[model samples]
Target: MFTENATLMLYVENVQAEYDFWKTAGFEILSKETIMDYDTFDMKPHADSTLTFKVYDKAFIKQISPEVADFQPSVLFETEEITELHERISGLTDNISPITSTPFVSFNFASPSGIYFAVKEK
Candidate 1:
């Protein structure tokens, strides 16, 4: 059985930049530390879940597990004001896709390290 204390870890090349992006997007940083040669930042996406950003040596990751270097997870954030969030993210990065309205209003944006995530209306 699993508990509500779930965390999604994202591996990135630049830890500070990714951390700044998430912080600028209004995610609160809980803690940051370096463990086992990897720099990790714990951020609160909501009250119950945490989103972690880990910075590791690319070559070392490739040597240990090549597939890990290319991993990109699709993370979604629920927002009540989609347009406001979209505008905020659009001003920060140019990697945001146009908001679509097929099933519901949603759009995806990329961090400086090229990790893509979506914000959907709640």
Candidate 2:
């Protein structure tokens, strides 16, 4: 069975814009390259992280798999410093939700393409 996740793919409308958002939000970029003549970015939560976040153009995916073009994954990020990270990210995007504790102290934020991701204390 598959266990380790080397990468998670994020297909967005604008690759460069989404890539910039993650970069500005403080994600470490591993590399930027062209796959199938399309721009793709590899990023991770930190420099030593094993999990990679792959950013690709939605149009490219649409061409390859039309049915999954609009599929956006629900990403939840765990951090030891939730409040601190939230505060730092707040300056980057205006579409961030205020922190709430339904069970754990957490909040949600949107990307440039209106895809929301969650962040919670570990």
Candidate 3:
């Protein structure tokens, strides 16, 4: 048997809004596709890797028992495009704000679902 990583998918409340947020967070558009059950769009900077966020109907959360506040944030994106992303996202979200220098210059924000994310130049 063989296995390969495909994508990191996040279930979001508003697909277009979350998509725009990540765009502001520095990820480039990868591709967009739809399945019988849902609509999804992926964004990434490289060919070998992908990050996808999907928006589905209420049934999508039908069995989500745990409180969303208890759900930990899932991924981090590192990029040299941080500045442009920061500017783009900051205007759209009240939660987006820049952080001081660390290993990389970065910013943090929340998705439409309130999932937190940080992006830094790598």
Candidate 4:
């Protein structure tokens, strides 16, 4: 049996850009670390954090790439104001689109850094 859940992680070329992307998309940053000269970024999170994203450099990937990946991260938010959140996000980022209802009531959008997200009513 599984002992715990998993977290999504990504290797990014730009740490600040990726971090800011999640912030704008409504994720709270639990913690972060950066190397001034190396331009390296390491991020840690609190146990209770709902959504967490970590951005690191290619060098970091060199060590973990065999097992890990350079995949993009996506997180869905459950919301009652799907319509409003969709419109508000779209207003700021052209990548956002209108709500798409199917098996579940939801709206889809892209973050400033190009991560796709969907919001559903729970």
Please tell me which predicted candidate would have the highest lDDT against the true structure. 2
Number of the top-ranking candidate, with TM-score as the measure: 2
Q: What digit string (tens of lDDT, one per residue) describes model 4 on residues 25-111?
A: 565566676544434433333346543455666456666564554466666767767776676677667776666668788877765
Clashing pairs in 4: none
Per residue, candidate 3 scores C-alpha lDDT tens digits across 1-122 of 63554555466666667666667655677766665564567776455563444443233444454344234445677777677767777777888777658766877887776878787777
For candidate 4, the C-alpha RMSD (Å) to the true structure equals: 3.9
Candidate 2, 33: how far from true, in Å? 1.2
Q: Candidate 1 clashing pairs?
A: none
Off by over 4 Å in 3: 1-4, 20-38, 45-58, 63-72
| Root-mean-square deviation (CA) per prediction | 2.4, 1.5, 3.9, 3.9
**Cα lDDT for residue 60, candidate 3:** 47
Report the Cα lDDT for candidate 2.
0.89
Q: What is candidate 4's TM-score against the reference?
A: 0.65
Q: Candidate 1 — which residues are off by over 4 angstroms?
A: 48-67
Candidate 2 lDDT score at position 78: 90
Query: Taking the tens digit of each residue's C-alpha lDDT, what string does model 2 give over 1-122?
Result: 97676788888988889888899888998899998989999999988787898888988998999898888899899999988999888987899999999988999999998899999988
The local lDDT score (0 to 100) that residue 89 gets in candidate 4 is: 73
lDDT of 2 at 111: 90
